[model samples]
Target: MTNYKINMGRGFKATTLLLVMSACILLSGCAGKAQTGTQGNAPAPGKGSAATNQNNTGGQPEQQKKAVSETEGLPSGVKVQKVLKDISLKNNYHKKVELLTDGGKRITITDPNGGLVLLNLEYEGTILEVSGRKVTVQLDHGGQQTMTIPDNMTIEDDDNLGLNKGVEIEWTVDADGNIQNVELDD
Candidate 1:
């Protein structure tokens, strides 16, 4: 009889310990998940985190969305301006106009408020013929162009980069379609 009582006490203690352990595990598992409150204002379905527009029902604050812009990171009072082909810049000069000729016609940027400006443009072709200061080139897409090589034009490559037939080249042009500079394309 004494052995039976001893065994029963031990079994009871083991059962109590198991129940406590199970309760602790269940509580710990539930603690990791977020819980929504039922008191205050909640957002509508598919709108935000909480339920329908019930305030005070709380969880976390809604995160603000970031705005996107193409002209982001540009200096204040600066803007990008695009110029079309065959447009003259003689009458549209800006105080801080910067020209970039990287394959299309030259572009001009003007700050209506007289601020800084940047213009991007380009043209590329293969040398077809070179006659004195005049060089004829076959446009990259599908056209023929004749540009006058300037006296001080810099060749941005080694001596092997000659204006010969089949040689690809990139150049910046002025408002009058004159070649301002040339670079050999590898």
Candidate 2:
């Protein structure tokens, strides 16, 4: 009878030890997997990482200068008298860009996803004449050019740039010759 009792105690101890060992192994494996899963969701490499990969500090500034100059190129017959904004692909992101030669033109281009991307081309000019949808403007660089106003263009005359002709104004545009926005220079 005593021997049977001793055997029962040993069996219970062995089973308990085995269960504890199994549980420990399973928990460790789950913890390792959880740590690895978090890495997959980490944010993408930031701008600093890109710079580090270049291996040369001088190279970074050269790349930035090139980017700014790439967009600074002006089309034929277009002159930037007062640079309102230095636009580049690194700065502007829009479907179409308009370069306004006249003031008192109000057009707003917005991105619903927020203003993460900026597209602004502004120049100062004087209104030469307003004839229906077309307005002739004397550019700062001593040339007169006419721009057609879209019927859907919004006018915000807070500065009264659009009140009459012969007003000095600031305007914004896109890559194409379509006006995006306009306002008083002051």
* TM-score for all models, in order of appearance: 0.38, 0.44
Which digits, one per residue and each the tens of the lDDT, describe model 1 over residues 42-113?
A: 344224544422532332121110111223333343333432332212222232222222224434333222
lDDT of each: 0.45, 0.45
Tell how far residue 64 is off in model 2, in angstroms. 0.8
**Candidate 1 runs further than 4 Å off:** 1-103, 108-116, 176-178
Q: Model 2: which ten-residue window has the lowest total lDDT?
A: 1-10
TM-score of 2: 0.44
- Looking at model 1, residue 177 earns an lDDT score of 46
